[model samples]
Target: MAALRKAIQELKQLKEQCVEEQGVEMAALRETNQELQQQKQRCVEEKDKELAALLKENKTLKQEKQRCVEEKDAKTAALQKTNQELKQQKDRCAEEKAVKIAALRERNQELTQLKEHCVKEEAKMAALQTKNQELKQQKSRCVEEKDAEMAALLKENQTLKQEKERCVVEEVKVDKKEDVEVKVEPEVRHDVKMNALEIEQKLLRGNIEELNMKYGKLLKIHEKDKAEMAALRKTNQHLKQLKEPCVEEKDAEMAALQKTNQELKQEKLRFLEVKHFEIVVLHERNHELQQQKERCVEEKDAEIVASHERNQELEQQKERCVEEKDAEIVALHERNQELEQQKERCVEEKDAEIVALHERNQELEQQKERCVEEKDAEIVASHERNQELEQQKERCVEEKDAEIVALHERNQELEQQKERCVEEKDAEIVALHERNQELEQQKERCVEEKDAEIVALHERNLELEQQKERCVEEKDAEIVALHERNQELEQQKERCVEEKDAEIVALHERNQELEQQKERCVEEKDAEIAALLKKQLKKPPKALCVVKEELVEVKVELEVEQEVRVDQPEQTNEPIPTTQRRTTPRWRRVINSFYCIRPNVNDD
Candidate 1:
């Protein structure tokens, strides 16, 4: 019994030690689970922060894309407006060129007709001069013939006077001889001499009247020829005065035409230069747009790759958390099995002890019956020995009674010990039941916590999925928008290319027109220069003096026109600065300088 008690005490101590050990293991498992939960919570927080940062970055990128799109749209709009304005300017230039060409053609025709008319007038003037010369020679010849006839008449008159003197002297001598003969012959001879003298005096008087009439007629014819020559000289002067003004007006018209041609040529060249500049600007803009597109695409690809990597990391974390949870659940299941096995062994040991105690109680009852029978036999013998052995028998009975009392006391102690042991077993069973209830509660709590954690993990997974879906949707939307923008850009590029081609064609046409204009201007300038030289050569001194003043005025006008052309470039909204203009090609600069200098020289 002592050994059994010792064994039972040892078993109780072992059970207490196992219970303490299980409690410590449960504490350690709880601590580890709490730490795992804390770590998972921290991981979730970090993932959330990363997701938030990624979202913020994505939003910023989208906003930048929108801003870029708006800026591109504004630039495209501005380019379109500029293109329209340029097209309008080109149209206006074309109209102006056409109008100028028509005016030039009309002016050329007028100049040609004027030249023909001038030629005819000059021929007519030459013919009239020749006719005037013929008239003057015929008048001189008439005067010479009249002078010779007058000389002949004067000589004859002198001879007639001498003959008249001789006749008078002969008449006096005849009168003296007749007077002497009359005295002798009587009255008939004196009457015949008187009749002959009277007839001679009447014939001399008629000849004197004819000579006076002839001298008066010759003086009247000389006065009439002098008056006719003076009238012809006046008419020739009037015709020359009338032709001078017409020739001067023709020359002025030619000069104006030449100036207009030069202006047109300059304008064409300016337009061509402006077109080339616009083309260069457009090409630069296109290149910049392409570079911007490439940069945007690269940035988007980088962002997508980063997001994908982040998602992969999150998935790995979730897998690690699940693995940890599975390991914890497996450990908990193993701990429950160990606790159940210990409880079963304790119950089996208690049953074996109860069977051994029952067998010992049956053997003690048989020994007590045999001891009662021997005591009865000993009482019989003491009676047989009678009174002489009474004292010794009495003493022996007392000893037996003492032994029975000791055995009862011992039985009472054994019963007390068994009662104590049963009480201890009941207490231990109650403690085990309490421990099992605690463990069950703990397991239920652990299961509930696990369920809650699972719920939280499921909710987190759903949230992550939703976030991924939203990110994908946003990315898809962005891609669609970028595709649309790319298409618009492509269309814009094609349109710009077409516009450039059109502009190039137009420029080529304008260049051809400018070349033709230049040729025409050169021709017109040559014609004007020839006309000026001819006028200088052919004009009378008084006409040349008038022309020099008019030429100076024309040159001044040409200079003013050239200055206006130079000022025209300044009228542009963004004119090239003087420094930039000075950097122009040498040939262009030389051409401009020549034009400017020529007019000044002509003015001088």
Candidate 2:
């Protein structure tokens, strides 16, 4: 019994020791649990702080991202605007090239017309020169013949003048003889011839009256003839003077015509030079256009590369965000598991020490509530950041619209410049025509003056002939000279007329040639226009392909973003235990309202 009692006492001691060890174990577990709870609380607080910091950082990142996105969108818009401007500039350049081609064609036509005009003018001038030479020979022959005729007439006039002087001397002797006869007769007829004498006296008085009337008539006739001869000589001299002036003017006009022709040739040369310049400019422009096309193609390739790289970057960022979200969700799941394990351990420990365990659980729950509130605040900040990004996108679109407007204005200015250039060309053509007409009028005036001079020379020849009757040798010589001069003038006039006819023929031929040249130029212009149109037809398809590719990239990016958002809820884990975390009636109602309202917002 003593041994059994000793064994029982040892057993009781061992049992008490086991109970003490169990208490120590429980105390240790409680201490560990308390430490774990504190650690969980600290972790929760740290997590909350980290989450708050993350939320704040995310808000800042979102704001920065919004700003970056706005800037990127602005850059994209600017690029698009630049692209649009480039396309417009290309189109304008193409139009300008077409216009230039048209202008060149017109210029070629004008040059051809000018060339034909020059050819006709040269032909006319040659014909005029031939006619002038022919007429000059005729005029020289006529002058020589007239000079011979004048010499003969002057000799005859000198003989007649000498005869008239001799007749005057003979008349004086007759008057003396008649006086002697009258004295002898008067003595014989003293008585018988007294009546006869009265009759004779009456006859003498009648004879005297008749002689006086005849003398007056002769004097008037001679004076009239002298005046007519003087007038004719003056007219002839005036005509000769006029003829000389006409010849001088004709020479001047010929020189002027030559100058004008030279000017026309210069104009043709200038036009040719301009055409060459235009061709060079066109070649340069074509090369530039080709370069521009290459640049556009390169830019398109770069844009495509950039788009692809951006897509890659966006995909990487999305993947990273998704992974981070997944990691966060996994962490939440691990935390929930840890919380469940702690709760299980606490429940088991609480069965042994219920009062202290309940108080500790209450403290843990209060800490959890504070962490959850902080998390909610962080979520609200993320939502606000998303709204800011959307506003930035809208602003970017507005900027793009503004850029488009600016490009349109620039295009309008280019069109106005084109119109002004056309107007200036028209004015230049008008001025050239006016100048040509003025030159023609001056030529007509010169011809009229020459004709007037010829008429005056004819009158001068008559005056010299009449004057030759009074003065013998001197008058005859002067008449001969005047007649020869008149003949020379007449010949000169005929020569000039022939020259003018030839000149007119040359002008007509030149005009016809000009017309042919114009036609050729027109044909060339038409060909150029056709070429430009054909080139324009080739450009549209390439631009469309580029635009289509950009649209496809945008579509793909949108779809990926949509998919990421759609998978967000399903991929996330439940962090709170449903049994332990009962939904507040107010929160449940608010959640229900939020779901209904959110769908309505989505629909709107």
Candidate 3:
């Protein structure tokens, strides 16, 4: 740029020197007529030579201007291409950022879903824990109830053993009383009474045999019930044992899931942090790009202003050249006028020389006119080149402005997207909170139901205990009444021996009626025992079948749960409501135990 400026200054100086030299030559021509003609010839030759040199300079100047304009056009074209490429890159970057942002949004949504799943799993775990605690309590209660029942059974066994010993002693006493009664009988009636006594003894023996058979059957039924109970206990224990390991495994899996969740949370945090950093970097980059654009625009504006100054300078130079041409022409015309007057003064003596000089002058004037026309055309061409450069610069500026506007719009869209994402997250959080509250409510209701069921079981146990005590009292009263009757009969027999002959017929009638009553009572007891035995036989199999079915269902459910776990490793299905359902089997076992024990005690 400095070299070009220096060249323009030199050209200006040369043009000024040419103009001064032309003026000096014309002034000398005006001073002397004889010298004027020869000086005019010299001046004309020098002016022609100067005009040729000026034309060469103008051509060189035009060539330099053309080269400068071409270089500027090439630079502008290359800058525009670069700007186009940058805009494309910016557009691509914006598209990529949007795509990446959408992908991140999807990832965030997936993470939120995972988090919600984790929360639900945690809720399930909590429910399971509560269920497990309830089951443990139920197991403990069952065990305690079993222990109490066993103890009661043992006590009943001891009482039965004592009752058996008492009954054996009473039977021996009764045999002694019978011997005394037999010995005291009147001799006249001894044979007939012996026959009757023998018949009665035979009948009593048959009744005893039937009672023994029934007792044995009842014992067998009781043993079977015991065996069934033991089996149920074993199965219950087995189920619990299996559950323990499975529960442990579930706990371990839950822990692993929690760890994975934590890792995911950390990863999400890191990703968010990274994304935030990237956004910050992008903002910084945008700011830097803006600054760079501002600098480029300033530079372009400066370049345009410089181009305008160059155009003005070019116009001034063209005007100066035109003024210089006109001055030279005026000087030539004045010289011609002087020459014409001189020609007239020396007419007849040198007419040919004068005419030849006029012809030469005309040719020189034609050459000057040709040179001026060429220069004007060249000036016009340079002006057009400047205009083109200015237009190209304006286009580059407009394109840059459009890119900036597009960038701004893209940024606004991104910000709106961010706001929407935040709002969605807030809504999701609110939904999760509501879900958690619902789970809490469910848990509380479950606990209340369990407590209520426990109270009902306690009341049932108390009722059973009361019934057992009432049955014991009734059996004791009957035994006492039977013993009193036996003593009264012995007293009456002693009196009958003393008052014999008169009361003999009445006593025989009373004895026959008592024997008939004994037979009827034995038949009724046998019928009642048979009915009880049948009932006991009917009940246990149904209970056992139900228990077995329940166990099978539990095992099936466990398998299903395991399959669900395997299929969806990242998610968990809700556990079954076993807290309530599991109690059924335990209560069934309790009822079965009660049933098994009740019949034996009642039979005694």
Candidate 4:
């Protein structure tokens, strides 16, 4: 720029010098013109032949002077134009120089700022480096601490595991000891008692195993939760790296961070894999426990049967003992009867013994009546106890039914969450499809702008590409998620249906049980009614026998009175028995144990 400015100044000086030289040349030409005019005047004065030649020469000289002036003017105008262009070029150059200077100054400022920034950055980097080093040291220390803690925790876990195992073993041993003790008591009994003992042992074993499996599952879940937390931290770090750029450094740092992120993602995947394995293990344990529970239930059922048999045996033994006692009482009664017969023969001459025996019989009948009343009270109490037991069983069934309803509700919530997930997936797929359509439209417009003749073709190609991408993305996504959702809903529906089926089965079972209970109650009522009818029949026959006895006693009294009247006929002629007949008793009293009725005997 300075060079150009100096060049322009030199050119301007040269132009000024040329103008001065042209002015001097023009002054000399003017002087020559005046001398020529004077020469012309002289030529006229001379009036000779040299005068025409002088005039021709003078005119030619005048033409040459005009040509010189025109040439000078053309050169001056050319110079002026050149000067203008140069001035413009100089101005442009000056502007360019100013721009360059500004740029240079800016660059210098930038360089200085950059240098300062570099220093600051260097300090920052040093600080960061120190921090990084500190972080590295801290990380190392953290790693060391974590490793130590992990080792310690692992050792503690191992010790806890060992203790758990020992506890499990001790529990098993104690369970076995309890089982043995339970067995020993039953072994002494040897029949149903042993069965009961074995059932209890099996139940205990099943419960123990179930508890152990649950504990193991809980432990595994705890471990999985810890692992999941670690994995989440790793994933969080990875995601942070992916989302944020390393603005402090270049692309290399970006690449490194990406690599680290990939590593972290891989680690997360590994953790997921471990979790899956743990889940599988837990499932297996659950399956084993379920099987154990099933076996225990079966054993319990067998024990119930055994207990029922033992109860029957005990009842039979009680009945046998009662029968034996009854037989002894009967034999004692026969011995008392023989003594009574001997006493009767001895008392044939003394009537007082007979009266005493009659009174004793009346006391014995009263005692029998008291015993029958006590038996009836016992029977009524047994019936009440049975009713209470039935009510309790019904309440238990109702509770189980409520639990089933809750389970069904939970299942419905799970189904709804699954549906929501499916819908979200579908929405995501639809958004992707819309994006694909938009991309295709953009592509079609781009193609249309490029080539009109091939616009349709380009559009078609774009459409096809978009369609293909959508097809692949949407079809795969839609098929997988839709199919999965469909399958899930199907499975859920099936599960719901299965649960309904189970509920139906339970309902059916309950209905069947209720039907059976109703049948039993009906049978019991029928039996009770039959017993009441039998007692009614027996009471009527006894009442008829008592009526017949009363009638016979009245008939005997009439006959004895008639014979006495016959023997005293002459002494009491005035009261001589008239043949007037007395009317028969009109009403008979019926005693029916729980009810008494009077029957009119007018027809009789």
> For this target, which candidate reaches the highest lDDT against the unseen true structure?
1
Off by over 4 Å in 4: 1-47, 107-126, 142-604
Compute the lDDT of residue 58 as modeled in candidate 2.
71
Of the two candidates 1 and 3, the one with more favorable lDDT, higher being better, is 1
Better of 2 and 3 by lDDT: 3
- What's the lDDT for all of these models? 0.59, 0.55, 0.56, 0.54
Candidate 3 wrong stretches, greater than 4 Å = 1-32, 183-604
Ranking by lDDT, best first? 1, 3, 2, 4
Give the local distance difference test score of model 3: 0.56
**For model 1, how does the per-residue alpha-carbon lDDT over 1-604 read when each residue is reduced to its tens digit?**
9999999999999999999999999999799789978966775686577568657756865776576556545544554454455445544545554454454444444444445445534544555576567767877787787788677667767766776787688768777877767656544555655565556556555655666677667667767767766765675676566556545644564565466456545645664575456445544644454465445444444433453465467458547755875775576567556645654664455445544543353353354346335533533443343333334434544654464455446446544654664576578568657866765685576667678768988999999999999999999999999999999999999999999897767666655665675577557656765656564564466655655665566556555644554444334323336985466543333334433332212334
User: What TM-score does each of the candidates earn?
Assistant: 0.32, 0.25, 0.29, 0.18
The candidate, 3 or 4, that scores higher on lDDT is 3
How far is each candidate from the true structure, as Cα RMSD in Å?
77.3, 69.5, 80.3, 68.9
Candidate 4 weakest ten by summed lDDT:
585-594
If the candidates were sorted by their TM-score against the true structure, best first, what order would they fall in? 1, 3, 2, 4
